[model samples]
Target: MSLKITFSLTASLAVLLSCAAKKNQQAEADCPPKPCTMEFRTVGVVFTDSKGDTLQVKDFSVTLKATGKKLPSGAEQSTDAANPFYMIASDGDKSALSVEGDTVVVSGTHPSSGQVKKTDFVISGGRCECHINKVSGPEKIVF
Candidate 1:
């Protein structure tokens, strides 16, 4: 009788320990102890015509390449076609751009544009310094 009780107790203890170990292992796998940090920046230029006339771009797009990642966005502006200059602005820490008066400024760090890393977070601005000319018709201008 003593031998049977001892064996049963040992077996029960082993089963309980195995279950506890499994639960702990599953919890560890479910939650990662360390999180990754990602950062980026956006850089580009604006285009204008020769007669100081701002060209109206129907659909403007920008692409940033880094870490095999591509980020794209569009711009909106007045449809007068005479003063049809559009400005792009960043929305959050992820990245964005905006227009201030005659200058177009880009904010945030793009992975491919400059020497930025995931560890170092930064925000910057660049001007699309272009000479303007008379707007005659529809055209594509790059800054």
Candidate 2:
């Protein structure tokens, strides 16, 4: 009887340990790693209706903003005074930009934009969204 009881207790202990380990693994899987930072830049060009063909206007401008803390020290930031566009570089993963038809849908990382990660950005004559990946660099906008 004692032998049987010991065996049963051992089996129960083993099952409990296995369940605990599984739960821990599940928790770990549910928690994802944090993201790094990157940088980006933007330039905007305007298209004007000159006679019949569309020409790029050199006097139009737009502004871009990010809902976060200021960029890191020594990080170069620039904007073209001739168009409506901007660039950002954060120590995070790939950022996103959304464009729908002739309008800019949205722009930013996942938590900020609340959009998909790898959606194709649409660019039109009116407005557009632009986001860069992990690197802070220059992006030219052609209207």
Best of the candidates, TM-score: 1
Cα RMSD (Å) per model?
20.2, 18.8
* Candidate 1 lDDT by residue in tens digits, 1-113: 99999999999999999999998577556543544334332222333544544444333433331232222332445456655544332322122222222222222222233
Q: What's the number of clashes in each of the models?
A: 20, 19
- Tell me the tens digit of each residue's lDDT in model 2 across 27-53: 546444545334343322223232433
Local distance difference test, candidate 1? 0.37
Candidate 2 runs further than 4 Å off: 33-143
TM-score of structure candidate 2: 0.23
At residue 19, candidate 2 shows an lDDT of 100
lDDT of all the models against the reference?
Answer: 0.37, 0.33
